[model samples]
Structure formats: C-alpha cells, structure tokens
Target: MNGNGTLIHLDNIYTAYEGAAFPVIRGITLSIRAGEYAIVGGPNGAGKTTLLESMNGMLRLTHGSATVCGLDVRRQGCEVRKRVGYVVQSFFFDPLTPFTTEQVVMMGRYGLLGCLRRPGEADYAAVDRAIRLLGLEDLRDRPIGTLSGGQQQKALIAQNLAKEPEILLLDEPFSNLDLCTRDFVSGVLKDLAKKGIAVVMVSHAFDGLPDGEIRIIVMRDGTLSLDETCRPDEVESRVRKASTVQ
Candidate 1:
C-alpha cells in the first residue's frame, strides 16, 4: 500500500513498565492503512493492550516513533486523539451519581466543543442520532448505571461515534458480550468499516467476524510474530494455527 494510505505507523517501538526487566513491546514496526479492519491477537502478557494504548498516547513511548494520521503520537497526542475514537473494555461511572444515557453520550462532543462552551442544537442532534443508531431510545432517559452489560457497551460505542472520529480503537469489546450481543456489535463494526472508518480492534475470537478482507497481527513474547492481510477464511485458519501453537 502507498504511504499516503497509512493511518498508523510504528517504527522500532519499545515500551516497558518502570523498573521492569524487559520491554512490553520491543522493536515493533507496523502500519495500518486507511479504511482497513485490523485485529491484534496474542496470549496473555504479550502487550496487545499496551500496543493499543501506545497508539493513542495512553502510554509514553520509551523508544522509536509512532504516527497517527501523519501526526507524531509523542508530540501531537492531543491532536491525534481528537481524530481517534477509543472504546475501553468496561465503563467506570459512579453508580450513585445519576446521569441519563443521553447526557453521557453528549459528553463525547464536549471535548470538541471546548471547556467554556455549552452544547448547541447540533451537538444535541448528534447525541440523539447516536442513541437512536445504537437503539438506546428506550434507555435514553434511564440512568446509565442501570443498563445491562450489552446496553452499557452500546452506550460507550455511541459515545465514541459522537466524536466523529476517523479511526476507532476497541480493546476486547466482545470479551464480556453474549453470543447474540457479540454478533450485533460485530455487524455494527462491519457497517462502520463499510462507511470508510478505519478500525483497529483487539479480540480473542477471530472466528466471530463477518466474511471480508481483514488484516491480522499476532504478538508473541512482546514482539510482532505475524502480520498479514487476508480474507476472513484465510485469517480464521491462520489464527487457529497460531493459537494452537501458543
């Protein structure tokens, strides 16, 4: 692929926890093109989560360089984050502090709106659209903490999409989801990819994805062990083999 299509570029990256004997990611280099659906797979302690965090500037790079949409992650983290959407595995909100689902979704737009400015009509419209798209109309006015796990996850996705980001990052989104919910969210992601939003996800279930072209990366011993672009069927076989070996 051409360099122009590259949205994420990592060259010789190294990251480690303080006082740790070894780096969590070592001499890693990879690039994700625009509109590509990619997944990172690894056994436990292989730095899959750390790699994702470093891409979004949640972790400081100990060595080498990372660029997202042509912006240096180390130097332009805030700017990079503005164009990127991140969905964590879990939501952490005070259960006692009541906030409506709609209100929680609106918070995504607040970062783009600035500290002093209040959300206007367009912002509210976007929030409503996100809620409707995620099928949260009935739960719109309900307290966020009262929703089920799947509903809460949908709310987080709605919040992420409200930012109108170019790249969406998801870490273990399907880990706690039921089979039906997992299929639903997977369909949503497929639609998002069709709309030309680049997606980079970390998941253990490689077989759950819909049939399409997908890029796969396998991590082992804190290093990139495999990187290939293949059809869904090819990816499944490859992933199965890799997982078995691990």
Candidate 2:
C-alpha cells in the first residue's frame, strides 16, 4: 500500500523488551490505507499484538518510524491515540465498580471531550447511537460485570465507536465468542469499514468475511511475512500454508 496516503505506516520497525536477548519485532514495515479492512494472522509469539500496539503508540519503537493518519505516533502519541480505538484481547472490570453498560460505552467520547470537560447532551446522544448501533439497548442499564462475555465484547466495541475514531484496532476480538456472536461482531466491523473507518484486526480465524475489498497481513517470527489484497480463496490457502509452516 501507498504509505504517503495511508492511514497507518510502519517502516523498518524494531521493538524489544529491556534486557531481552532478542527483539520482539525486527525490521518490519507495512501500510494500511483508509477504509481498509485487514487481518493479521500468525502462530503464537509472532508479534501480532506488538504490531497493533505500535500503530497506536502504546509500544515505543526501538528503531524506524510509525505514523497514523499522517501524525508521527512517537512524537504525537496522544493525538494518534485519539484517532484510534483499540480493543484488547481481554476485557477486565472490577466487580464492585458501578459502571453501567451505557456509562462504559460513553467512555469512548472521553478522548474527544478531554478529561477536563464533562459529557454533554450531544455526547450522551452519540453514546446512545453507538449503543443502538451495536444492539446493546437491553443491556444499556445493566452493570458491566453482569453481562456475558459476548455482551461485554459488544460493550467494549460500542465504547470504542462512540469516540468516532478514524481507525479501529482489534486484537483477538473473537477469541472468546460463540459462532453466532462472532458472525454478528464480524458484520459490525464490516459495516464500520464501509463507513470509511480503517480497521486492522488480529485473528487466527479468517472465515466468513464480507465479499468486498479487504487485505491480509501474515506475521511470523516477529516479522510481517506476507501482505496482500484478499481474494476468494485466500483465507483457506493462507491457513493451510501457515499450518504447514508450523
């Protein structure tokens, strides 16, 4: 992809934990364009999570550079984070914390409103829209801790969308979901991409994607091994290839 007009650009990146013998990610480069839906797949310990973190500036690059939406993620970390909504592999909540589903979803707007400003009527409306969009109305007033795993994931996604971010990053979003919920969430992501939001998802499974323009990135041994446009038979072929390599 063209990095100049891309929403995300990583060039020759290297990242390592302090005092570690080997780098977690080494000399990786990739670009994702606006409105693109891409999936990163690999075996365990392939740096898929690390690459996603670099996109949002959560992990500092030891070398090379990363830019998101034309902003240098390292130099403009806060700004980059504001435009990207990240959903991690696990959703954790304190059992006693009293945040309702609506309240949790409304948190997405905090980045836009900033810490000093309070959520106004418009912000609340946006939260409502996001909740309705994600079909979370029945659970809107429920305590977050009481919801099921799928419901919690939907709430997390709703929270991210409420921010109206330019890009969405999901790491193993379907890991804990049933098949039905996985399909539903996958459709939601496809809808978001159609609305012009760039989406980069990390998944081991790449089945049932919408029939449209999409991209795939394969990661292995802390490097981006393959990046290409998605084709009809691509997923199965990649899966077979990855299986053989392992």
Candidate 3:
C-alpha cells in the first residue's frame, strides 16, 4: 500500500488489443484505496472494461505504468492477479460441467496454492467463509451449471471472495440479476468494502447501491470524464449527466 493506502495505481496508461489500430483505453490515470466502493460508469464501448483490465494487468500496457499492491503490473502480472480478484461481464457453464458450487469457489484459491500443493484446512476455511458470506450454503453441493443466472452470479462472487483479494474488480455484475437479487449482491459488495477490500465495479444499473458515500468514475471516448465521491443516491444522476455531456 502507498502512503495514503492506495492499493491500485495507474499512471498515464494506455492499453491495446493485439493488432488494434489504437489503444482501447488511453492516457488513463487512476488510484483506488482500501475499503473503497468505486463504480465505473459510461456508455457502451467507452472503455470502462478496458480500464478495469488495465488495473489488473489482464491487458498489455502500450504506454506508461501501473502498480497494484506495490507490484509492477506489467512485469509481475501473476503476482498481481493473485492479489486481485476479477469477475467478468458474463459467464456460462454447460449443464454437464460437473463442478459443484463448492468446487467452483475452491478454484479461486488455486493461484495461491502453487503447483502440486493441495488445499489445506486454511483453504477450506476460506471457501466456507466466502460461501457463508454469499449465502450459498443451500447451493453449495449443487452442480454449478444447474443454478439460475442469479444463483450462478452469487457463486461466481463467492469464488472470487475465496481468494481473499485486496482488490476486487467486477464487470457488469448485475446484468443478470433482478431488483431484489441486485440489492442482495450490492450489500455483499458493500460489506467487502467495509472489510478493507477495494471494490471497483463497472455497471449500468444504479438502483442497488448501498446507503453510503461512493466513488463514481465516468468514462467517455476512452478517457475519464468524471471522477468524484458522492452519496449513493446521487450516482445515477451524476453519471448520466457526465455521460451525456458532449
């Protein structure tokens, strides 16, 4: 962590896809601190997902630098990934995939387990804690592929939480959830932030934010348009206003 408890830092960074004419996200500088709940908002194709990838080193940096957990993002991506948990925009499992919800969540600890090392008591304990936190005890033994979309979403989150990451990045996590489920999931994320985990999420839905001050980041044309802290109730309007500004 930095002097101010900044857990993730990106300095004038540019990220590009292979063979792409230009960077997907350019000249982006961002800092996220422990126990923060930051929402990344923007119109589609505005580079919100790219920014999240840049922070976790999932994409190659074409220019500038990034540091997460005091490690160089480009050179130490493996280590960075261990400390960062990312839940993608969407995921699906075949009905016959065979992994149980408990098994799926246990996968999150694989990176830390190293090759040929099996999970010990600590690993199982962590997985149990995540499952309980996500209220997945009822579905723990069920085949992950058979769950409803919202159930699967909760399972995925539990999987990430099992990693005990310092930074958690989520992309469009609420896309498949109903209002009630959204509220439930939002509360889980809020609790994560309270526990000193940096929670950064990209989402279009704004109705389910927890009651508290939150950070809103709006992107436009691959750059930052707005970055500020505001109460949860003000987020939708502020993001909408910023996104519409020409």
Tens-digit lDDT track of model 3 for 94-161: 98889999999999999999989999999999999999998999999999999999899988999999
The alpha-carbon lDDT assigned to residue 72 of candidate 2 equals: 91
Worst ten in a row by lDDT for model 3? 204-213
lDDT digits (tens) for residues 117-171 of candidate 1: 9999889888988888778899998888888777888888889888887889998
Give the better candidate number (1 or 3) by TM-score: 3
User: Highest TM-score: which candidate?
Assistant: 3
Worst 10 residues of 1 by lDDT: 237-246
Model 2 spans > 4 angstroms off: 1-5, 18-21, 242-246
Off by over 4 Å in 3: none
lDDT for 5 in candidate 2 is 47
Ranking by lDDT: 3, 2, 1
Instruction: Give the CA lDDT, 0 to 100, for residue 129 in model 1.
Output: 82
lDDT of candidates 1 onward, in order? 0.83, 0.85, 0.93
In model 1, what lDDT does residue 110 have?
A: 78
Give all TM-scores, in the order shown: 0.92, 0.93, 0.97
Clash number for model 3?
Answer: 0
Best by lDDT: 3
Query: What is the number of backbone collisions in each predicted candidate, taken in the order shown?
Result: 0, 0, 0
Q: Looking at candidate 3, what is the lDDT of residue 111?
A: 97
Select the stronger candidate by TM-score from 2 and 3: 3
